[model samples]
Target: MSKLTKYLKITKGVRVLDLACGRGRHSIYLSTLGYKVTGADLSENSIAYAKKFENKNLTFMVHDMTQPTGKDFDTILNLFTSFGYFEKEEDNLNTLKSIKKDLKPGGRAVIDFMNVHFVSKGLVREEVKVVDKIEFHIKRWIKNGFLYKNIRFKIEDENYDFTETVKMITLEHFQKYATKSGLEIIDTFGNYNLDRFYEKCSERLIVIFK
Candidate 1:
């Protein structure tokens, strides 16, 4: 929140859109700070959960991130690596275009993504974790310009498997998307603390643009 206050330069009553907000954590926080915030997500369950915290200044809705949520928001936030789930590159680019369309003329946006180079260099191969009495076997790998994670877990007599995939998008790739979407890259940080971004060492690719 401190990083947002600094980078976005937002003030009280500023309109904010939390795009792809899973459960409205950020929206709730910003609303408490006096911002008018709307948290939108694709999942109905997530929206329902988030709605429990809604007040006059905060709300949640089910909306697709690849489409325009609303018009003329002062700030738009796409955090926690939520921008790269689409399978096609065009879909990913469209998401940026949607954000550009929804923002006010001078509106700002923050995209919190993973640093591709850092993740590739320090990729974890395999690991096992036990959570709530369930053992999860996890494996990670990079292939064909995408990062992949396979998770397998069991509960009692049932088996479950899931795969998470994200495109290995670098700063250069995002620059192209921003240009095409009529947005400019203004600043970038390595992590939540707003440290200067180092391509090879940074853990996050947090871009601030307008």
Candidate 2:
């Protein structure tokens, strides 16, 4: 668990939009906290799963963040390093600009991303996990400004592999993009504890902007 949800407080009646809300983890939590929430992702499977738990205040949509959004939102969340999946830096910037345009007056955003400085400093090369009779090995690294990870899983006689890559957008890069997109950076949190960011101490970057 990333624990990023602990730092959020969505006030009542606010319309919150969560981009790339995989599995609806944060969406459900925000709905329970009084915000009218919408979980949008490109994955229809995720939307289908989200529909299973729908309430009057909660809705799910199939939205590709790389494209334009028609609905305005009071608060938008791009959590868990979800911003950098775009293949290019400008593409990522465009997404932020779109978010700015879709947000209502005084609306805010919670952009949660990996701490690039820390990831660059302590690159994890290998990791292993066991899940429900499955054993998985993950190889991760930073190559050419992109974070790459390969997951190999074997459960009984079944085997699966997945490769994912993300462009590394640093704190400075995000601040510049936000400014360029007309969003003001209000505060930055280092972790779930809401501590002030330290150059080498923070594990993640959580920015609140409007």
Candidate 3:
């Protein structure tokens, strides 16, 4: 949060929209810093959980990020690699357009995504985790320009399985998206500390734009 404040030059009372805010952690923190924040996500359960922390300065709602949530936000944040969920590139581009549409004039936005190069080079193949007496078997791999994670677990005689996929978006791809969305790329950082981004060495692809 300190690094984010520094990067955005955020001040008290600024209006912020936490887009795709899974559980409103950032929105709650920003509200505590005196910012008026609204957090929106697609998950009803996540929004319900997030609403437990709401106050006059903070709120949460269910929203689709590919569409405009609201207007005139001083800053919008899409953190924790919250993007790249859509299978279609056009939908991903539309998400960027939605962010551009929701911002106030001269408003800034941040997109924190995984460094594709770094993740591809260090992909973990498989693992098993036991939590609260449930054993989760996980497998990960990259295929057809996307990263995939498969998870299987059993609890109380029931079997659960899920697969997560995220497009391997690079800085160049984001630059193109920014141009198409009428947003200007102001800065790019490697990590939370704001180091210069190195495609292969960086752990994150953090883009600050307006």
Candidate 4:
């Protein structure tokens, strides 16, 4: 888990709701810190994998965050650039509204998103990595506020390739939508450590709201 997430979980008796929690990484960390955590994602496969780490304070469920939810929570987390995965802008805004509805009064939220401007300015057209005997290569860039990332994995016997594109909106866009959803932006961090925004620098925009 990221240190920023650990900082957020320091509140006492917090009930944390993690949206689109693939594999329950942050949820598990929050749970270990004594915060009640519920992780929701659409992938049953990911949920099944996360179940391997089940504990008394942590739970996982299948949920499409673009829709409505009934559970009330004290703090909601949308981490790791998961907010822009939905193609429809209205769906994303409505999801924020739904999150506000599910939050307890005086509750807060943490939304971590990619810094689109920085990425667009300093886009990495190609990158590569190696894991064990497998070589993983990626080609990523931004065009018209949409981020395109293509991956090619080469193993000893086989190769696999896939591409994922997300609408890369800026931090101002989220502030607008979150304000319409009744959540006020309390603070913005350039990355996990809370720095100022700059062109061609920083990868994440961490927004705290209430």
Candidate 5:
């Protein structure tokens, strides 16, 4: 996050929007650095939890990723793989457009997304785990270039299933969406260390746009 703030040229008194922020971790941290911070998330519980940190320079609210915010900000952060949850590609693109719309002129958007190529390379077929008396049987695979996960859990004889699918959106895809949204790609980093990205070797694909 420090690296991200530096890249975005965030300084004291700047307004920052933590889009899809979960529990306001980054928002609260940014506010401590004297930046006005607002965290928006789809989860009501997360928003409620985040409100505990609210103060003069910090706030949180429920927000949908596809919708534009009423205010613009000097920096917008979508961190920790907080994107690509939608079922449709268009929905994902709209989220990018909303981020572009919510930024002030010359403002930067920092998006932290998974390095799909690397994940696909290390794809785990199946596994089992027991945590807190619950057993989880997990399976992962790639189909049509999209990663899918299905976790079957059993707790005290009760079973449940969870499904997740995220499209393998590459940097090229990002460039396409950014161009369509009237934004320009400025930089791309591989991980928190700020290394240059390698599609096959990088652990993450952190992108910056303006």
Candidate 6:
């Protein structure tokens, strides 16, 4: 989140909210810079681990991004493809709405997600991995305009199946959602270092909006 440094030049204090902040790396860095940072995640384990770093200006909590937190924030960071996990498109839109609700009148938001236009061009269909004593067979595909990953794994004599899905959302989709959620995108970057975004080449879709 070093890219965020450029936007932190405010004369007074800044309050930042990090959505899907697993383990709270971004929150920690921002807090060190004197920003009042709050890291929120649905994973109990992640939040518990992040709480260790809590201080007067830094905190972590379990939260569902789709709901409103009712606290105004100066900056909101939704990094690492954390925006589209909901099964319903409307639920995903709610996440954006909640971000808008938490933002101060002139607050900014940054959402970093995978560039679907580029990823689709080089997508892998299948793979296998063995971690520890467990073997995992993974399959990937796109259906209904969404990307899906299926994992079949064996732990000792037990077999388990899991699936992950992302909407393959593009910049166009975000633009539509942002407008309805009262946000106006101010900039778009392609990488962590704040490079230009490309439709068929860039690796990341990082947008800074208000």
- Candidate number with greatest TM-score: 1
Distance (Å) between predicted and true CA of 98, model 6?
1.2
- Comparison by lDDT, 1 against 6, better one: 1
Q: TM-score for each prediction?
A: 0.98, 0.91, 0.97, 0.89, 0.95, 0.92
Stretches of candidate 4 exceeding 4 Å from the true structure: 1-10, 155-157, 198-200
Which residue pairs of candidate 2 clash?
Answer: none
Q: Which of the two candidates, 2 or 4, achieves a greater lDDT against the reference?
A: 2
- Across residues 1-210, which tens digit of lDDT does each residue of candidate 2 receive? 234444445567879898899989989988887779999998999899998988988999999886758888988898888878876778888888888888998888888888888888898799998888577899998889899999999766888899999988778888898889999898898877778876676998888888
Point out the worst 10-residue segment of candidate 4 by lDDT.
Answer: 1-10
Q: How do the residues 1-210 of candidate 3 rate in per-residue lDDT, one tens digit apiece?
A: 788887688888889999989988888889999999999999999999999999999999899999997567999999999999896889889999999999999999999999999999998899999999899999999999899999999989999999999999999999999999999999999998989999989999999989
Clashes of each: 0, 0, 0, 0, 0, 0
Error of 3 at 107 (Å): 0.9
* Model 1 segments more than 4 A misplaced: none
Give lDDT per model, in order: 0.91, 0.84, 0.93, 0.82, 0.90, 0.88
* Tens-digit per-residue lDDT, 22-77, candidate 6: 99998898888778899999999999999999999899989999998889998898
lDDT, model 3, position 207: 95
lDDT per residue, candidate 5, 138-169, as tens digits?
Answer: 99988886888999997677889999988888
- Pairs of residues clashing in candidate 4: none
lDDT of 6 at 1: 58
Where does candidate 2 have its weakest 10-residue lDDT segment?
Answer: 1-10
Ranking by TM-score: 1, 3, 5, 6, 2, 4
Looking at model 2, residue 41 earns an lDDT score of 93
User: Candidates 2 and 6: which is better by lDDT?
Assistant: 6
At residue 194, candidate 6 shows an lDDT of: 83
Off by over 4 Å in 3: none
Can you tell me which runs of candidate 2 are displaced by over 4 Å? 1-9
TM-score pick, better of 4 and 6: 6
